[model samples]
Each structure stands twice: as structure tokens, then as C-alpha cells.
Target chain A: MQDVPELVAQAREGRPRAVARLISLVEGASPQLREVMAALAPLAGNAYVIGVTGSPGVGKSTSTSALVSAYRKAGKRVAVLAVDPSSPFSGGALLGDRVRMSEHASDPGVYIRSMATRGHLGGLAWAAPQAIRVLDAAGCDVILVETVGVGQSEVEIASQADTSVVLLAPGMGDGIQAAKAGILEIGDVYVVNKADRDGADATARELNHMLGLGESRGPGDWRPPIIKTVAARGEGIDEVVEALEKHRAWLEEHDALTRRRARRAAHEVETIAVTTLRERIGDLHGDRRLGALAERIVAGELDPYTAADELVAGLTDGA
Target chain B: MQDVPELVAQAREGRPRAVARLISLVEGASPQLREVMAALAPLAGNAYVIGVTGSPGVGKSTSTSALVSAYRKAGKRVAVLAVDPSSPFSGGALLGDRVRMSEHASDPGVYIRSMATRGHLGGLAWAAPQAIRVLDAAGCDVILVETVGVGQSEVEIASQADTSVVLLAPGMGDGIQAAKAGILEIGDVYVVNKADRDGADATARELNHMLGLGESRGPGDWRPPIIKTVAARGEGIDEVVEALEKHRAWLEEHDALTRRRARRAAHEVETIAVTTLRERIGDLHGDRRLGALAERIVAGELDPYTAADELVAGLTDGA
Candidate 1:
């Protein structure tokens, strides 16, 4: 392994390979992870985290690419973390993501990484925030976390970011489906991508109607605005960036930024603590405690709830 | 708080209200859950568990209704547990489901229950199996576990059943999407519903083509067959029943049924144990241990990994 101080120095200087290696260590949960995180901790909390999520075939990748381009043009160092918790293989989707963002691959100002939810103890919910910390500490001005907006993990990703952008496209019947998926609650800014399509106006109208239906945010509460974008052609890219900036400003003005970061830190700490406890329980597998409990449950000697209580009592001290 | 013995007896006699009460206890994780489960344990393993899952808007509820009708025609008692882990209100989807299945709602031999994933410690993966036990103990010859084929929870539902049926519709591009969601691997039988639609044949052809791409099962191993049905009009309903029976027989003949049940039990046990430990940690929230650990990590005095290790040690007796 490379020296932790030297790697931290290189990463802070915006060396792509050094940043990549640090993220790898974080993802792999290496023995030196503590030292690496300790070195990076002071430099963290500088970059703004933005999350982009939407249903599949919704042009999320294209929209994300346009945002990266817009940020680069503004002379900001940007990082992209493409998170796919469902797919284990990085071959198909990651390859597609790379091909879509190939234009910026050679640009040193942009760092792109694809992370799958394989082999992670706490799933993407845990791995993503740590990766965000790495990028934030590595001197990036902005970081984008893009995940497929399908399940609970997507919601978790949205909560991890400073600004959550929910992307949708026209003619996908996504407006109603989005409501069913709880997308309306998590999105800070809604994007109707593929605005050049036929039903783009209808989709945007429906979204506005639904947003109106939500219990109105109180006075001074930020109202999420809908924007239309033809991401494939790079149209409306500037408006999306501007909306992000406005949301950030709103978050700061309302003093919601500290509250959000505090909530995020609490979640991370809980996840790590819970994961560690589960590992200890996992180590008890071959031991007689869990096995005896399972036997009693299987044999109808006790219910699983009781067995679980007994097992927990065995693991913990009375206090 | 009825007497557990009397409630179990009433449940075993196929009393609708008694069955409903037991399932509610399971869903609530009530204090009496353990007693109820203990009473129901011996009566489980009698019902044939079938899981129906597919993308939304694919007529899953309709197909489930058709299956209930077909099973009733065969003089077998049926129980339907519509497990919707995503929705909380149970207002829209469950109401629609109740209306669709109203035909069987009044039948003495048919019991239908809707379960939402709200406020469960272990989520649907833990709740669904216990609910199945309640239905199984109620003397139902067949239990249908229906879930939307979207996320990890759906896959967990599939594994809990003896036979998993993957439902798809024509022209939804669901063939490719199902493969991406890992739905293809979990299904023991595939059904292309809405077979009267325009692209029914194309959908079936694509499913068959994808099935062919998989590695060959050994000789005498069961190969999942793709069947077509227009479930709304009851068209081809008999074929789905026949396919399910064939798969069940295949499982029984190969000793796979026991293996599947064992695997399900192991998963349930592990989930319960892990959840119990998490609850203990949740109880530790107000204690200064977690707060101190968080402060150390946040202040860069310790990495989260090491902090987690220390927190775990603080909980255990060094065993």
C-alpha cells in the first residue's frame, strides 16, 4: 500500500489516480481505511453533493452528463459516482455510462467512478456516503451521486445529498408511477427530461398538478420547481444547473444545511454501528447460541421472536 | 388478547375472522406474536406456497384473481397475501386489489389479506414468511404471495415461496427489464399475461430466447416453461395451474422442496437475529456510547471503522 500522507496529498491536489485509489480503499474497507479516513476527514464537507435519480429509460445518464459539462464549463472541479445497487456486474450499465460520458473522460477536471452494491456489508446506503466523503475531501467543487430511482436505496441516496433532482421523461406514464414510488416526497427539484418529445408538455403539466396536490410547504418552505430538459441535445442544461444553485442557496438560507448534514452523519454512524453488530452476530453462526435458537424455533419449542430476544440477550451485557 | 389456543384452533378450522386476527398479530409484531407463532408452527408446511410477481401495470392482481378462481374450482381452499412493500397507505393499490378480488372475498373457502411493509423491524422479507405461516396454519391448501417485481424485496418474496411465477405483459419492454432486475433467475415458471395483446408472441419469443441463453440444467432437471394467459377473461387459466402443479411435482421429485424450505427458514432466522441486535443498538441511542463514537469520527479523532469496532466491543462481554 502507498503511504497514507502522500496519497492524501496527491488526492487533495486533484490527481485522478490517487483519488481513485482512496475510493477503492474506502469501498474495500481495507485495514488502512481508518488511517486514510482520518487523513481525509479534515478536508471533507467542502464539496456540494447533488443526487440525480429517476426510473429507468428516463435519460438520467444524459442529464447527468449535461450537468457535468455545465459545471466544467463554469470552471468547477466535478466528480461523478454512478451507483447501481441492483446490478452486480459493472460490464453493461457502467460501460453504457462511460460511453455516454466519454467526452469528459480525458478532462482532468472531471472524475467519474462506477460503484456496484456487491460485497458491501451495509449495501449502497453505507458505501455511497463514504465515497461521497472521499470525493468531497479530494478538492472537488461539486459531486454528483446518480442512482436508478427504483427502490428504497434510491430514496436513501436522495437523502444523502444536499440537492435531490428527480428526473422523468415524457410518455412513460412516469408521472403517476412517480407518485406511487414516493418520488414526489424526496425530490428537491423535478426534471422532465426528453422535453423535445411529444408529451413533454403534458408530463410537465401533470407533474406541476401533482406538486400542487402535495400539502403546501409552509411559508418560507422551499417549493420544488419543475424544469424541462432535452438532455440528449444539451438543451436546458444551464437552467438545471441554475436550479441546483438556487436550491443550495435556499437550503443555506433556511439553515437546513446543518440540519441535513447532522442527519446524514447520524445515519452513517448508526449504519456503521449496526453493521459492526451484525458482523459479531455473524461470527456466532457456528457457535451453539444461534443454532440452539434456530433449533427451538424450528421444532416449535419457541417462536422466532422469543428466540431472537434470547439470542440478543446472550450477545449483550445486561446494561 | 384472546386465548392463543382457542385462536389457533379457530384459525385451523378455516374461520375467516380468526385467520384475519392471526395475520394482524403477525403484521403488528404484537407482544403476543411469539405465542401465536408457537401455536401455528406445527400446522405450517401444509399449504402449497405460490409467488406471483411482475412489473406493475402487468395485471398481477387480475392474474391472482384468476388463480384464486381456478383453485376454487378444484375444491382447494386458497389464501391470498398481497404483499406490497413499497406502498404505505394501502389506499390506492390495495383498494384496487380488494375490488378486483371481491369475487372471492365472501367465499368461505377463500381468504384474502393485504399486507403493507410499514413499521416493520425486518420489513416484508420477515413479515411475508410469518404471514404465510398464519395462512398455512389456517388449513388453506394453496397460498398465493403476490408482490410487484421491482426491487430486492420482490426477490426475497420469490425465494419464500415453493414456486415462483414471473408475470410479464406485451409491449412493455419488460423482457429486457426483467432480466436486468434478476427476475429471470428467480422464476420457476414464466407467464406472459395479456396474451391477447399485439406483442404477446414477441414477448414469449424473447422470453424463450433468453431462457435458451441460460446454461442447460442437468438431465432430468426442470426447465422453466413460458405460458401465456389473458387473465382478465380467465383465458388460459387452466394452463397456469397445470404449470404450477408440474413445477411442484418436479420440486418434490428432486428433493428440492425440503432444500428450499430449509433455505427459507435459515434466512428468516438470520433476519430475526440481526434485527434483534439492531433493536438493542437502537435502545443504546440515548446512551453516551454512540454519541461519543460519532463525535470521535466526526472530529477525525477516530475513523468510522475503528469507532464501529469500539462500539461493538462496548456492547459485548468479550466473548
Candidate 2:
């Protein structure tokens, strides 16, 4: 309900409430979303986005919490956007995870928000970048996006980040499972969490082997480092952070960071355009045009492609 | 590349190879797909689509196989589109399941195809209805769409059916899980498979209670029936078929079948239109316009909404 400019100003002044409100606006797809985004536009592009993702039992939350602690220790303003793509329910199901992250609750430099994609118009794909932008504009030096599951959406969300960290535990058949989940291609830094457990070394070795199998890297290319960590005990997390920094440095050196950000922006713009157009098409459902076309298709008098052509023409002509 | 007309003619004449080729074209998004869809248009709208879905261990494939046998016993031509949304690998990963479905392989009245969403451009959403169109045109009186997971996509595919059948086993904590998965809202008929198991009655009772809790049906509304079936032994399969037929009759009597089919066609048209626009946007990536807009957004000179507006304008203007 606050003015967009006032909210953006407060967010930039390091008010966590304002930051949370901005993200809520994004998640709710508020009518003032455009004004808020415009107000925050110049304030963004300052934060480094790191996406942490893996299977359910691989300690993604613990690893993310540990990373948050490490970043806070380094005197950086950090934001964690915990995204649960699998849950249709929003916020309530993630209350326990938020409680686990309570160590940073009182810290002014750390802001945490949990998002669910079930009721969002374009799901996580459309809402996440905006949420990240809100955090970036709120003066967070590092933004961590943690996803709950290992589905296709998780991989996609992770891939949208400037750096993607994939966590695996020992003896989970994770190496091959990661390959099957298509996370192997998106990870810039691989972390073997729960290192104190047995078979950790073997898991790391298998992951290393799998990473090397088909990828032929040219000189100057970044070879993602595998870091082992016992996140529950806060062990080996610094090395994970170090690997992330090294990857970021490599990306910057090769100008891949600019290209990657551009690609991510392009995807965001495309998703917004497509989502907006889809909404317009949905609006046409109340009109008889789309219904008549559907009836014709159902009556076997028109093919869907031809009908789609007519619909597109109508949309463009109206525009 | 066989000619589209010749392939459609052969497919309508009950040639399984032609049907397979047509589905392949849909899956591949072939250059001649428009021609094929136009050719298949007049022959579709005959097959009644039924979607079968559930969790991985719920014996969905077995139930589907039993249904195929029941339909074949009735001397009706049937086609099964087994969609796997979880597997990133295509037909190769589903070959084993195809072997499980081999009972109907030699039957001239049955056609089976396993599709994976990983490599497809528009995923299962865009490709599924087209594949269903192909099967409908191939003279199948009944089409069963069986998905291989309990994720959001499975729920979506099932909801697209004229009659959605939700399968559950006895002892998997399935009653509550089904509610959480949003399947309870979509099923027109519920099947409690593995009825010989110990908790069969309890599962059915729990499901019935859950289904009754929030729903306020009117006097003439179609109340979903829960059937117990030991699909492995073929027991209670006829009841499931009868339930499906009754649901179909109810749909027809209420004129809901025409409305459902029209709604499905509208969805198909919208998906095609969006997919075509996305391809055009992808083509713009090589032209530097999209890249330029992305650069401005990344540089904080533009917000994604404004960038998206420009992109949409370009697309519509070009159109």
C-alpha cells in the first residue's frame, strides 16, 4: 500500500520490511509491480546471485544456512530467497525452515524470504527474477536462491543465477541422479555435503569422474571445483565459498558474467512477454472468438494450428 | 519423410507404423507438422480421451494395461500415450516400460507410444494434445494417456482428460498424499489399486472421507466413485471401465463433453500460439535486438517489464 518510490527508498536504506514488501508485491503480482520495478531498476545490478539446489535429503537448507553465516561473517549484506516449487501451499509449509534459519533473524544485514510458486501466475520462472531484483535493489551484496526439490523447475531456477551450486551427500546414488536431473550441466560449484559421513571421498571422486567424462574444456575455461563440507557442523563451508569466488572471478575474467546476465535478462523479458500475452489470450476466453474457434476445432472443421494462427492474428491486429 | 497425406491415409487405415510416424512428427516438431495437423483435423474428435495418473509405485502402468485389455475385449481400437515428465532422456529411458506394456504390442487394435518431455521444444503441454490428435485421427475409439510421475505435470495432463482416473495403492500413505498433490480435485474416478493388500478398505474409506470433506455437490452433479481393483490379477477392472463409461454418459447428457472438448482445443490453440511466438523471440536472439534489450536491463538502464514491452511490440509489429 506504500508508494513505490518511498518503498524503494526505504529498501535501499537497508530496511528489511521494505525489502520484504517489495518482494511480496512481486510474488503477489500487484498492480503497482511495474512502478516498483521501475523505481528499483537503477538500484539493482549490485548483488551477486548464487543459486543452491539439490535433492530433498541432500541438506540444501543446512548448506544454504551455513553459506548465509559465512557471507554475514564476511561483513556482506545477504538475502536468502527460499523457493519451494513442489509445494502448492505458500509460506505456511516453509515456516519450519524459516525457524531453522532464525539465527540470522535479528541481523539487519541478513534478510530471508520463502516463496511458493503454486499460485503465482507464471510460477517461479516469472516471479523469481523480480524477487531477486528486489533483494538486489535493497542493497544485498549477495543473494542466495535456494530451491526445495530436484525437479525440472529447480534446475531451471538454479540455472538463472550468476553462479549455481549443487550439493550432494554420500551414498545417495547422487552422481548418476544428478546427471539424470540435468543439474550436472548447470552447476558452477559442486559441494559434497555431510563430509564426515562414510563414503564421502568416494562420492566426491565419482562426481569428479562424471564431471570429466564428456566435457572437454579448452584452456581458460572454468573447471568447476568439488568442495566437501559437513554443513551441520559448519565444516568446509569456507572452501565452498572460496570455490564460488573463484568461479565468479573466472566468469568475470572471460566476460562470461556480462553474457550470462544478459542471457538471464533476455529469459526474464521473454517470460514476462509470453506471460502477458497468455493473460490476454485468457481474457479472450470470455469473448466468443476463442470459444467459437475451439468449437470449430472440436467439430473437426478446423485444426488447432490454423486456429492458433487466427488467434495470433487477432491479438496482433488488436494490438 | 513420407508425404503427410499418404501417412494420414495409412494411419487412418490402421497402420501402426504410420501412427508411430505421425506421433514422432508431433514430438519432433517437424517442418511439415502444420501439413500433418491440417490433414488429421477432419479425422479427429472421434476418440474418447482418458487420462490415468498417480505416484510411481501406485501401479498406474498395470491399471492402464488392464484398461487396454478391457477396451480391446470390447473390440474397440485403443491407443496409449505413456508420457514421462521426470525423465530428461527420451524414448530410450521408457523402453523398459514399453516392454511391460508388451501385452498389447501384437494386437492390431492397440497402439502404444512412450514420450519423454526432456528434448521437446514446447514440452508435454504443447506436444500432448497434438499427439492425442494424431491418435484420434488414427481411428482409435479410446485413447489413454498415462503419465509416469506425481509431479505438477502429471496433475495437469490428467486434468486435461475427459475423464481423469487417479490411481492409488493401499499402504503408501496415499490418501493424504493425493490431497497434497492436488489430485483429489481433478479425478472423475478414483481407483484404489492393489486391493488384495491389507489396508485396501481403509484407503478407500479415507479417500472417500477426504473427497467428501470440502466438496458441496448438487443433486445432479457427478460424484466421483472410488473403485477397488487388483489390476495385476485383472479383478475389478470391469467396474473401472463401467465407471468411466458412466462418467462419459453423464458428460454427454449434460453437454459437458462438447464444452470440455472446446476448452481443450482452446488450450491447444493458446499453447501453439505461444510456442510460435517464443520461437520468433528465439530467432530475434541472433539479431541483437533482444540481446541489446537484455544488456540495458542488466546495466540497470531498463526494467524487465519495459524491456518485455519493447520485445512484445517488436513481435506484434513484425507480425
- Which candidate number maximizes DockQ? 2
Lowest-lDDT window of 10 residues in candidate 2 chain B?
A: B87-96
lDDT of each: 0.80, 0.85
- The candidate that wins on TM-score is 2
TM-scores for chain A, candidates in order? Answer: 0.90, 0.93
- The top-ranked prediction according to lDDT is 2
TM-score (C-alpha) between model 1 and the true structure: 0.76
Error of 2 at B282 (Å): 2.6
Quote the positional error of residue B29 for candidate 1 in Å.
Answer: 1.4
RMSD of each: 5.8, 4.1
Docking class of 1: acceptable
Q: For residues A165-197, write the lDDT of model 2, one tens digit per residue.
A: 999999999898888888889889999999899
Candidate 1, position B234, lDDT: 96
